[model samples]
Target: MIDWLDFVVLSLLALGVIFTVIRFVLGPKLSDRVVALDTFNMIIIGLIVFLALVFDSKLYLDIAIVYAVLAFLETIVFARYLEGKNNDNS
Candidate 1:
């Protein structure tokens, strides 16, 4: 039941995930890797939402919401850790 537009969007999302993975792996700094991980989480949320739409299922959207919340919390923790590290060096 998926249309061409849906296919295109999914393809783009996949490509984005691939590039983000590269960034995550090759990032020279902890912050860069954290940013890439955050971006990857967002892309995964997008994929979940899109899949929910394509399959006409609300469950996927609910999962996406939970995942987004977790990702946000994780990002905050990472930020705090980085801040603490910086303070220790100062």
Candidate 2:
């Protein structure tokens, strides 16, 4: 059933979260870690949306939207910091 498929997708996303955690732990560069963190945030948002769809809860969708916006802002802030560091090194 389609519901079963959604469960599978959620499990796969959980695996992705684990992988991202590993990358965050082992990444050689700060940028590499930041990229992984960004990926994790995006994945979390996607999972939330999928859960909302499966549960037929409109509230979850709103939460997902807020989370996405916050994550995007966090990514932008980190990027700005990295840019500043690069400029300083130059």
Candidate 3:
């Protein structure tokens, strides 16, 4: 049974994701978009952990940990690529 608190948390998370998506879409710079993407990933991990808590399941927490690692690696790669691109342009 879902509770009011769960509904509120989920709603807020959903809204946060929506705003991040909007920022990603409308960002004036590639770095801005990358940051938004990274933030989105973090938000997803948060959602996964929240679900794990709400359902009392360890699997979701495990999944969130794995996802967080991957997201961190991906963001590092993106940052490196952006740095190289900027250096090349300058």
Candidate 4:
């Protein structure tokens, strides 16, 4: 059965996503937007973990871990692109 704690955690995670999305939308710089995107990915990962707990399924946890790895790679790729762009500007 779902509990209050789960609900509370899910609520917090949802709020986090909303705030990060706002940041992503209002970013004055591309770097700031990239960070916001990464943060959004992290919050989604948290949601996946929450789903896994609620469903009592290890598969969801596994999915979350794989998603986390992908998100990390995505962040690295964005950072590299920014770095190259900055170097070209200099």
Best by lDDT: 3
Q: Write the per-residue lDDT of candidate 1 for residues 1-90, one digit (tens) a residue.
A: 549899899999999999999999999999999999999999999899988989998899789999999999999999999999999999
lDDT of 4 at 30: 99
TM-score of every prediction relative to native: 0.89, 0.86, 0.92, 0.89
Q: All models: lDDT?
A: 0.95, 0.93, 0.96, 0.93
lDDT of 4 by residue, 12-70 (tens): 89899999999999999999999999989988998998898798899998899999999
Q: What value of lDDT does candidate 1 attain over all alpha carbons?
A: 0.95
Task: Kindly give the stretch of ten consecutive residues in candidate 3 with the minimal lDDT sum.
Answer: 1-10
lDDT string for model 2 (24-89, tens) is 999999999999999999999989998887888999999999999999999999999999999999
Q: In model 3, which residue pairs have backbone atoms overlapping below 3 Å?
A: none
Model 3 clashes, total count: 0
Rank the models by lDDT, top first. 3, 1, 2, 4
RMSD of each: 1.4, 1.8, 1.3, 1.4
Better of 1 and 4 by lDDT: 1
Pick the winner on lDDT between candidates 1 and 2: 1
Shift of residue 63 alpha carbon in model 4, Å: 0.7
